[model samples]
Target: MAMHMAMEVDQADDPRLQAYTSIREKDLTSGHGARFIIEGKVTLETALRRGRFKLESLFLAASRLEPLADLLAEVPADVPVYVAPQDVMDTVVGFPMHRGVLACGIKGEIPFPANFLDADAKTGGPSTLLMLSGLSNHDNVGACFRNAAAFGADAVLMDGQCCDPLYRKAIRVSSGASLWLPYAHGGTGADMVHAAQAAGYEVWAMTPRAKAQTLGTLRVPEKLAILLGAEGPGLPDDLIAAATPVRIPMSSGFDSVNVATAGAITLAHVFGARESP
Candidate 1:
C-alpha cells in the first residue's frame, strides 16, 4: 500500500502532481487500466460530500481542511487521505484544484467490430458502416464514432492511419460512445472498400470535388459503407476515383463540412434510404 499523505494546501500545483494528473486523465479509457478522475475541492469536507464520482482517494490542504469526524468514519480504515496546503495542492496539480478530490476507476472495454457483426448478422445485415481513412486527430476520430452511433450506423472501421479508438481523449470526446459503439482497426482504406463491396455493399466516397455525383441523387443500395478521408488533403485521388463518389449538397459556394459532420449527414442519408426501401 502506498503511504497516503494528508497535508495542507501548501504544495498545491506541484509539477509532480500535475504530471500525475495528466497521466491519470489520459489513462481513463486506456486498456492498460480503467477510468480515473481527479475532482478538485475547496476542503476535505467538500471532497467527502461529492461522493457520487466514487473517489478512490482524497487530497486536501492540510492548513485549510478541517478533519470531518463522520466522513473519516465512513471511509475505509486503510484508505489513505492526504492533506496539503491550498498552495501545495495547487502547486502539485499546476492549477488550483481546491476541491482536492481525485479518484480512479476501471473503464469497461469496447466491443470488437467482428463481435458486433456476428451479433447483428442475422438482422437484415448491416445497412450502414463508417470507414475511416488516415484520420489522426483523436478528437475527430472520437467525434466521428459518436456521430456514427447517433446517426444509426452499424459499425465503424478504422484504417491504419486512424488513431486508436480506445485512447483516453477519444473516449471522453466521444461521450463514452467509444466504449458502446462497435469498432475495428485494420486494413487499408482500399482493402476495406474492396471487402465491403465484396460483401454486397455499394461503397460511396464522400468528397467535395465537383466531378463526384451529388449525394441526393445516388441510388443508395440496401447496404452502404461511407468512406471518409482526413481533413485538408481529402481522400486519395485513387480511392476517390475508384469509389462511387457521393457529394453532399451544400450552398453552391461553400467548400466542405467537417469530416465528422459530413459523415453524420451521409450516414443519416444512407439509413434514411434504407428505411424507405
Candidate 2:
C-alpha cells in the first residue's frame, strides 16, 4: 500500500486549496493549465487506476476519507491530499459537492484521428471509430462517449465545435468513459471524413433522408468510421453526399432520433457486424 500524507484545510481561501474555489466558473473560463477537475468517487477512482492522467491534488470531505483510505493509499507520496469538512467543501466550490470527492489532474496526450485509426489497423483487430460534428451539447457528447465505450469503438473523432469530453458534468455522465476512451478534437466534419478515408476507413454518415442506405442492409467495412452530427441540424448535405449515407430504420412518423441514441444503435450494429477471420 502507498503511504498518504493528507493535509487538512480549515479555510476555503487557503492558497493550497485554491483549485477547489469557484470551480464551475474556473472550469468555464480558465481550465487549470494542463489540468482538469475530476469529480465524484467513480471518476476519481478510474483515473487513479488508469494512471493516464497525473493526479495533482485531491480534496475530499474528512468524513468520507475513512471509507476511501484504501483507494487513497494508491496515490503517490509526492501528491498532496487535502481534507475538509463537507460544509467547507461546499463553500469552496460555490455549490454542494454531494459526492464529496474531487481531484485535479493533468490530461495526457491524445492522438489525432488519422494516427489513432492507423494504429488500430496495425493492431490487426477490426477498428471502429465514431466521428462527431458540431456536437456542442456536453450531455450528448458524454452520452456518445459512454455509448462508444460500451459498444467497443476504438476511438472518437470530433470537430472543433464539439464540447470537451473532459468537462466535469460530461465526465460524470459518461461514468468516466471519456477519460479512458481515445478521442481527437479539431477539424470540420468534412475534414474528419476525408482524413478517415485517407486512413483507409469507409465513412458512413447517419441521416434520416429517405434515399439513404438503411443500417441493416449496408455492408459493414473492416475499418469503419461512423459519422454523427448535432441534435437538430444533423450532418451537412455536402458531407452526407461525400460519404455513404446511412439511416436507422424507425417508424415513419419520427423524423430522427437523438444524436447520442442514434450513435448507440449504429455502434451496436457495426460492432456486431464484424466478420470473423
Candidate 3:
C-alpha cells in the first residue's frame, strides 16, 4: 500500500508531463537536440526490443502501471519512468488514449558518403545506397528505409528535399525499422546524383514515364544506386536525364505505383541481381 501510494505521488509530480506535452518537431529539435521523436507505446517498445534502443526516457499513464509491469521490468532501473493521468498524456500529445506509454530516444549518427561508395579507393566493396530526392512524405521515407534493410541495401542517402526518416510519425509507421539503417545527408538533388556516380555507383533513376525502359529488361550492375522521387511529380526530367532511366512494367491504365512501393520492388530486383553478380 505504501509503495502504491508513493507511485501515485510520483505520478502527480511527474515532470515528464511538461516534456511529453512539448514533444513536436521543433521541441524535439530544441530540447535534447533530438532530430526525431519516437511517440507512443508500441513504437517505443519496438525500438527498445530492436537492440538499437535509443530511448532517452519513458512516460506512462499512472493507471497503466499494472498493465505494463512486465514491459517496464526490462528497462534499466536508472532509466527515468514517469507516470501521469491518461488525460494528461493525451492532452500533451494532442491525441487521445494511446497505449499509455511514449519514449524519447536519441537519433543515431548518420554515416559518411564514402562508406557507401568508392570500393577501389580502399574503403570496401561497392556498397548499395538509396537516394531519395524530393520525396516529401515521412511515411514513404520510413517505408523506403524498411525495404532498404529487407533488401540488404548498405545505406540510404536522402537529398535536401526528402522527408526526415526519424520523425515521430515516420518512426512509428516503420515499426522502428529506421533506427538502425545507415544513412547520410546527400547535399543537393543534382549534386547527390553526381556524387553517387562519381563514387562508381551506376545510378538507376526509376520513373514510369512513356519512354522509360522496363527495370526487368535493364542490365543490373554489381554496384547500383537506385534513385526514387516524390509520387506525383515522379523524377524531374533533369534528374531522370541525369540518371540511367528504368521502369517497372505495369498493366496499361494503372499508370504508376506509389513511390515507396515502386522503390521496394526495384530494391528487391536490384538485390537479386547483385546476388548473381
Candidate 4:
C-alpha cells in the first residue's frame, strides 16, 4: 500500500491532542462529554474492527507507527492519527506506561436501559443477559463483560452502583469486549430485573445461599437474565427474594467465587451444558 499517512506531534500541549491529555484524571469523571479512552494495541484494534464507537483520534508512540501500519491504514482519513516520541507521550499521559497505543472514542447517544433489554428480539431466537450490581471494581466489571461476550450473551445491564465499563483499565482487561457488547449502565438493580422480566426473560439472581437452586440442577431458559452482585455482598436479600435464586455448588464452606467467575460458570451451563450428551 501507499505510505501511511500520519502527523508527527512534537509537543505534549499540541491543540489536536487535547482529548488525550492527563487521561487518568479525565477517567476520574464520567469520561466527560460522553467520551472514553481506549488504550493498548488490542483494544484500539477491537474498536476499529467492531465500529461500535466513533473514534475521535489516535495518538501513538513513534515506535508503534510502523508495527501498526496496516491497522492505521484502515483508519478513516478524516480521523487524525498523531504520532509522538515516547517521551512526549509519557508527558501527555502523566504516567509511566509501557504500551504505545491510545485512542479517544465518542460514546454518542446513551441508550435507555429498558430498550436495550429488547435489542435481541429481532433475531427470533434465544437471548441471554448478564446483569451486575454494586460492583465498584473496574476489573470485575470488565471481566464480566468479557465473559458475557464469550458466552454469547445478548447484552449486559449494570446498576448505577457498578463502575463504568468503558474506563480505560476495564477496556484493556476486557480485551475490548465492552466496545461491542450491548450494555446499559446507571439503573437500579431492581430496574434491571424488572426490565429483563418484562422482556420475557427468566430472571435468576445468583447467590451463595444454600437454599437457592444449584446451577447444575436448573434448566436453563431461552431468554434469561443472570444477576450477579459485588464480591463481598452477593445479591441483596430483597433482590434475591424477588427472583429465582441460582447458586454454583462449591466444596464445603467455600462459597466465595469471584462474581465474574460465577457468571462464566452459569453462562457456560446455559450455552455449553445442554449440548453435552
Clashes of each: 47, 0, 0, 0
What C-alpha lDDT does candidate 3 achieve relative to the native structure?
0.72
Candidate 3 on 1-277: residue-level lDDT in tens? 1223313323433465555664552445323355456666677667667636456767777777777676777676555676677776766666775667677666645443444444333254646778889887878988888888889888788886776777777777766777766676546778878878887778989988878888888887767889999979888889999999888998988878898899899999878877773
- Give every collision pair in model 2: none
Q: What is the per-residue lDDT of model 2 for residues 105-178, given as tens digits with 9 covering 90 to 100? A: 77655555656555655445578889999998979999999999999998889987887888887888888998
lDDT for model 1:
0.65
The residue ranges of model 1 lying beyond 4 angstroms of the native Cα positions read 1-21, 24-126
Instruction: Tell me the TM-score of model 2.
Output: 0.92
Order the candidates by TM-score, highest first: 4, 2, 3, 1
TM-score of each: 0.64, 0.92, 0.83, 0.94
Q: What C-alpha lDDT do the candidate models reach, one value each? A: 0.65, 0.84, 0.72, 0.85
- Answer with 1 or 2, whichever has the higher lDDT: 2
Please write out the lDDT profile of model 1 over residues 137-233, one tens digit for every residue.
Answer: 9888989988887888877877767877656456556655555566776557777677667666788999998888998897877788889999877
lDDT of 4 by residue, 26-121 (tens): 763364368888999889889998859888899999998888888887787778888999999999998854798999988876555676765545
Question: Which residue pairs in candidate 4 collide?
Answer: none
Higher-scoring candidate on lDDT, 2 or 4? 4
Quote the lDDT for 83 in model 1: 63
- Let me know the TM-score candidate 1 reaches against the reference structure: 0.64
